[model samples]
Target: MTEYSAFKVELTEHVVHVQIDRPEKANAMDAAFWSEIVDIFQWIDDTDAIRAVVISGAGKHFSAGIDLALLASVASQLGQDVGRNARQLRRTILRMQASFNAVDQCRKPVLAAIHGQCIGGAIDLVAACDMRYCSSDAQFSIKEIDMGMAADVGTLQRLPRIVGDGVLRELAYTGRRVQADEALRIGLVNRVYADPEALLVEVLDIARQIAAKSPIAVAGTKAMLSYMRDHRIDDGLDYIATWNAAMLQSEDLRIAMAAHLGKQRPTFRD
Candidate 1:
């Protein structure tokens, strides 16, 4: 229920809808954005009533990436001393990176509903989500190469896992615009809708489905999947064994089993 300058956050049922609200700026990531995102997701992680999230942008586009003014501010602060500038810039980059890391690390499932232009840092943002869906008009690019810099955020690290090395390398190197169809073909998005309205409707419905599930099971599933991304299969199996040993004791399991046996709907307690 907290108000945010860069976003409009609303909770309905157990799903939280986070919309980037700076339409006049194409929902660009400004100074407020980087800091507010981390706070919002942290709150989502701590709230038991919230079970799922759908993030989308308001207006004509999802996002145009990091605000140019913000980037300019960083450039303007560079000192003549090379060592000091490097140290300052590195710290700044890490801070921005943590903003998206919050989305990646959130225990609740985060689904991105993208439309129109999803460029540069926008790619990095959506790449951190558990799932991505876009409108037919959506176009994505790894725009940092065109801006005379390497993508310093989560894109370079996380996207390769989502879209594979070959496709990611091609996009990163060329900065070519990938249309909605191509994005789906390359696995950048799970599905494409005719328009932003349809896109949000379906994605939010998916989030609702996720919210209806047992929160403990969903969290464990996300944790196991995230863990397996870096660990070996055997390690993942062992980890899950330890995980489920504790999770199995949750009352949710008994409630779910009783509902099944009684042929009735299950209602889980937060």
Candidate 2:
């Protein structure tokens, strides 16, 4: 219900649709974007009525990445003090990292509906999502290297696991665009639609499927999988065993069983 300067937010049924609103700027990540994204996802994490989320851009492109003006501002802020400048830049990078980290950390499954160009910072945003679906015209790039810096956000840390080391490194090194077909082949996107409108329909259909499931199970599965991604096999096994031992008792399980026996769809309360 809150107004956002950089995004248009809509909640219908149980899925929250978030669109980057700055079409004129190609949805570039400016000051409002970097800070508002962190706030939005943190809010999503706490809202119980929400079950799934879909992110897309308002106009042609998903995003053109960080705004040049913002970068110039950051450059100006850097000073002659070697130790102080390093510390300041590190802190700045961490804040930018947190913007997308919120999406990664959200308990609910997040799906990205991408179109046109998904550039540097845009890549970071989608990398944190649980699933990605793009338009046939979409293209992605790891452009930070060309900008004289490494990708310091979720892309570097998260993308290698999605795509392999060879693919990720090649993309990072070359800063070349990966078109929709190649992106799908590389496992960067689950599916590619004919266009942005079609992309939204399919992504929303998937989000609705997720929203229809038992929240307890979906949230627990998401959390467990996220945990397992960072932990060893045995550690993950033990963790899930403990988690389900307590979480398995939700009323939704009983509802699901009853629905199965009655040949009906299960309805869950938030």
Candidate 3:
């Protein structure tokens, strides 16, 4: 039970629940957050017992986005050399981007259970998830436009695929809040619940279901899906054919077949 400064993590029945724990500050992404998240998701990736993950906020809001104090600190570190400042800024942005990249690269399925205000960088966070679900009270925004900057993280890149180009452009350009129903309509969220409590209950159940599946099958599916994002259909087919050539021989496949023939629920190893 390792503790974290910006998050609370728990593992139950092969599912990991990762909560942004800074409710008092609306779970703002500070320096600690940017660094700690990469570590947390990496741990999730390496732990075989973690078959699925659910990410959510602790209290009122999912997040208020990047903490202004962190921005101010970065600003304070800037000096008179414009070239040096540019290099430093690029490094900082890339570091922040890697935090979400870790979530995207995790082998386990990552599900976002959002509630309240999921704004700015929080949008980037959930954009990296495999699936998203929210409560009726959830309000999402691509808020960097309101802050006088473009979103430089995963939101601008990953969201176009999730919400489609036109809808993503409207949200990113306008910085308007999309309520839960609209989120569902635009394919941003799979489902919406009456409240956060109900949202977590159902989303966790979904994670449990996914966790019950053969880990090898799930990981291969996720791998192929991620590969297809940048590759052509033919390339993806070739890659998967090569992948399954080795993967199909896994013992879990035999276990799954036996369980199916026996008319019993499959129990897979971690």
Q: Candidate 2 on 18-103: residue-level lDDT in tens?
A: 99999999999899999998888988889998999999998899999998889999999988999999999999999999889889
Q: Say which prediction, candidate 1 or candidate 2, comes out ahead on lDDT.
A: 1
Q: Quote the lDDT for 241 in model 2.
A: 92
The C-alpha RMSD of each candidate to the native structure, in angstroms, is 0.7, 0.8, 0.7
Question: What does candidate 1's lDDT look like per residue over 48-91, in tens digits?
Answer: 99999999999999999999999999999998999999999999
Residue 17 lDDT in candidate 1: 96
TM-score of 3: 0.99
Error of 2 at 237 (Å): 1.2
Model 2, residue 59: what's the lDDT? 87
lDDT of 1 at 257: 95
Question: Over the stretch 44-138, how does candidate 3's per-residue lDDT look in tens digits?
Answer: 99999999999999999989899999999999999999999999999999999999999999999999999999999999999999999999999
lDDT of 2: 0.94
